[model samples]
Target: MSKSCQGLFVEFVKCLRESDCMKASVEHRSVTECAKVSEECAGLRYTFFRCKHGQIDPRTRIKGNKGY
Candidate 1:
């Protein structure tokens, strides 16, 4: 991931930690919508990336369908 994308993910995690409503609300939005909000809040352009199973969930032994 790019630096800006990493930063946005960090900020999104922080927001999830700070607000109970945010977590619940985010579930209502699609993944793309969530990424758009994160990018806009961080003042960065969004880029879509794919993550294989091990790259995302290390605990998972199976590998497939890990993109968002």
Candidate 2:
């Protein structure tokens, strides 16, 4: 991951650890059922995704990364 996206990545990981998704994963006792579709983390995930994609996209590169 790029340095610009690291902050968002850290935030996303923190959100995931605190979210019910982690609880569900614990309950199931398997990684296969782990779901990152939680409502709270959705926007963070989207922002992180956009930031990462922007790094490689020329058009977005011109517009600049909207690092959050």
Candidate 3:
């Protein structure tokens, strides 16, 4: 069986919701703050990849940076 997270549909759905909320609220924070938080979250890259629930979210990225 694939260890990929694509199987966890519910988790993918929840990630979508949180991404939306984060995107919507992003404008409320300063660029510096966004960068700080984004870095903090990115630090959890290993956990995100191991999620086996959902992949990393673009909206969870910095406000104006392209994703890797």
RMSD of each: 10.1, 2.5, 12.9
TM-score of each: 0.29, 0.74, 0.23
- Give one digit per residue, the lDDT tens place, for model 3 in 24-47: 774686533543455334434334
- Per-structure clash totals for the candidates: 0, 0, 0
How big is the positional error of residue 22 in model 1, measured in Å on the Cα after superposition? 8.2
Pick the TM-score winner: 2
Q: After superposition, how far is residue 14 of candidate 1 from its true place, in Å?
A: 0.2
Per residue, candidate 2 scores C-alpha lDDT tens digits across 1-68 of 67889999899878877777677665554322332557778888888888899999999788778776
> Rank by TM-score, descending?
2, 1, 3
Q: How accurate is candidate 2 locally (lDDT)?
A: 0.76
In model 3, which residue pairs have backbone atoms overlapping below 3 Å? none
Please estimate how well model 1 matches the true structure, expressed as its whole-model Cα lDDT: 0.44
Q: Which 10 successive residues of model 1 have the least lDDT summed?
A: 44-53
Q: How many angstroms is residue 61 displaced in model 1 relative to the true structure, after the best TM-score fit?
A: 32
Model 1: how far residue 50 lies from native, Å: 14
